[model samples]
Target: MNEIFVKSLPLKDVIANIAEALDTTYFNRCNEYILNIPEIYGEGSIRGINFLNGFGLIEYNCTLKEALKIHFNVNSIHPLKFIYCSKGSVKHKFEEHDVLHQIEQFQNIIVASTQQNGHILIFPKNENIHLNSLEISRKEFKTKIDCDLNILDVGLKKLFKDLTARNLFFYQGNYSLAMSDCIDTIKTSKFSGIARSLFLEGKSNEILSIQISDYEDDKKDIPKRQILRKSELVQIQKAVQILKSELSKPLTIKELANKVGTNPTKLQEGFRYNFGLTVNNYLNKIRLDYAKEQIMIGELNISEIANNIGIANKSYFSRLFKATFQLNPKEFSLQIAKNANKRQRNRPLT
Candidate 1:
């Protein structure tokens, strides 16, 4: 196992420390630090960005050849950490605690070690580990003009105000689908310069707020919070049925979302989580499947088939059909007709 100690304060120093320990180097872009893993070590990179108000984002996407242990041993009051495992599981243990927590895919954990204590993150060997950590320095966070920590509810106020780390804090639960989208945006962000800095900072703040809300909802034991509610499932099913029944009519995502009594965001998420396809893609699949069935039935020509399956243009339908099945709709339909005629001719006299 390889052990890397990050004895630093901010993201820049932390990334620099890792890069140095591995005998490689890191680069800086608009205050964001990126450490590309040396080929001798593994394939992947560790990147991080820090905002002025003490919030930071660290992304680790890697498949290391051996087990790696990253120890954050910064002294003084350590930064609060909101860690989310997006792809693979990771093991974590506070320096002051013996219990190790495993954060699996789609799960998050909020951890704050006691004063001068630190965090241990363990990534198993040869696994695709992808996670993001939102770190906030409470002492510095309180100084932000808009912080207004006192206005926050009692529990969050106390949790954020533990400057001396009087209480060791740790909470774990599945993250919300909305937060998953935010994280995905962070991953796919292409901005640079001031835009990059501002965008990342905004997203980091959003993730933190969602994390807080999720924690509060967890404490309240809200069944409809992070977990998908029955209503949502029913709406998803209803959306599918609507699409199936309206094969000759295409609906916009907004229209579908509205008919289901849900917003576009939730509808999009429902499709992603439950159906594993985008709304438009799923609709197109349904229409094309119906068109195939209609063609195989030998009742409609290509143009009629397209019209019946919500495709106004035969050329477009043909392109989609070819793309999906690698066969022309007209040829496929004629072949079906030919097969039926041949079978009819081969039948024995009754």
Candidate 2:
């Protein structure tokens, strides 16, 4: 058994204390706390930024050299956390539960723990973990709902039903692609200072909205014609990786299916079931997003971007871009340039 570090405080203070305990330096910008742990902790880092007074975003990326357990006994208010494990895994042990709840990669977990008896997180050694969490204090959450808890999704309502109850509620599910995209944007954003904080805050709230909407959609009685088994799910994910890796090549659905050792039907159904997009739609989305990124870089022309993304018909690519982003490729490129110019002009004299 590894040694556990226990702390009883509000969430933000707990994060700062963890950095201090590990002898790390942290930046306390207005509402953002960026903690960079030393090499002794295996290059661990945590970024916490508050949006509202009691609502915030936490991004954790680390490879620990030793096991660390953080037991958080909430001091001020019971907190509700919406957590996504993007890269690795984590285990949560509640005070009242004997079983450890596992949050694996590509999964989301929602937890509401009482202030009197909070939860614990155990991080194992030598494994790279990336987690993004959206935390809201109970009081703030209730205020946002106008004190009408009934407006929450059934799953969320159950998790937060009895705020005064001294028990922990946990719900775990597969996160949708929309949520994943938001997380990736937040992770890879190049903005800094106030721009960075605002970007993170907006994306965090977008993730929360997507999660709640997805939960409600799951509750609806959608037809289950394309049910995929566990092994088939793995195969489809491999296909996705292959598609992403070979983006420069124009691969047909048949080629993709054969490469992943699955039939075309199963591959198509898997995309629909797991990713909520048809085969062509998904591939087009990938290509368009890549093209838009290249435009943002301001390095490639519209036709060159189209060619690089394997689309020879520039007009068709422009139409796809319009449909996806409501902006044609040229218009989007000009917008990026305009924004860059504005940022340069707005820079303060130092």
Candidate 3:
């Protein structure tokens, strides 16, 4: 196994360490540590990790087969937390006492100051382990969540992931040493009571938001898989049935969330989680399917189909039908007609 480990003790000491690590021949060279890794590792593949601590981001693009650990001394004064993921499919064996729920594929894992005490195990694409670390300061985080959490909650995970995914976005914009200093500060001190509470609250709210967003995305994007919790599935089943029976009118997201006994965010999330599609996407799919069935009966035109299906826009409906089935509404109707004709022709000679 080939291993290269490097550490920087302080702002000034960083240079000496780098110099010492590289001898005279390999010296007179300039080297810097990237805050995130942007490549994947495997046979015939180039994998690397990068972190942009100054920009509050981390990313990895390699695989590992054993348990790996990185312990850092964060100044208690400024704590940091981030979402981490493997580039390709990777299994994580989080310590027994840590995870509140099971972690699965496409699952967003939170690495906060408190939950940072554990080993991260990865199933590698090759016979090696590669890791990267990103740093964010508690004070910088406070600025992000100082206001009410309602807005930031909607896309916390996305923001965190995006930060790591786009290294240039963070490192290219004056975030190099500034972020490093912030991280160094956190490694050595503690925070006051008020700041600590605010920080914890921010982390909790962000995590909740991340889960909610995933749930919503799933409901809209997924169709064949059952992914929601038992309770959420029960709620979605009820909502779907009710919506089907009341096809003449569409149910608003808030209404569906309320009827399903969940908040709008939760209801949407539950719908996504259970169906792998967002609530709106699933609802539209149901509406379109119903419309197609009605069209087979030859009782409605495009306008009627839209109205009956509770779609607001006739033009939009046509486009959506084409998009969904790769055929225009008229074409689809004619195909159905041809099928019916063929079936009639093949019917028993009675």
Predicted model with the maximum lDDT: 1
- The better candidate by lDDT, 1 or 2, is 1
lDDT of 3 at 107: 33
For model 1, name the residue pairs that clash. Answer: none
Q: Model 1: how far is 324 from its true place, Å? A: 23
Cα lDDT of candidate 3 equals 0.45
Off by over 4 Å in 1: 145-153, 222-350
TM-score of each: 0.68, 0.65, 0.35
Q: List model 2 lDDT by residue over 1-350, tens digit each.
A: 24445343344576677877787667887668788867877777887777765678777899888877877776655578888888879898776677898888888877877666777888878889998878877665666665656887766776655556455677777776567667778778899888987887788778888878756655655432222333347888888887777677867998887787766766887898777898888888888889988888878888888888788888898899999899999888888889999999999999
Ranking by lDDT: 1, 2, 3
**Residue-level lDDT for 261 in candidate 2:** 74
Instruction: Give Cα distance to truth, residue 23, candidate 1, Å.
Output: 1.1
**What's the lDDT of the predicted structure labeled candidate 1?**
0.84
Q: lDDT per model, in order?
A: 0.84, 0.75, 0.45
Candidate 3 residues 274-343, lDDT tens each?
6778878888888888888877889888788888888778788888888888887888999999999999
Query: Candidate 1's residue-wise lDDT over 48-74, tens digit each?
Result: 898887889999999888888999986
RMSD of each: 9.2, 13.0, 14.8
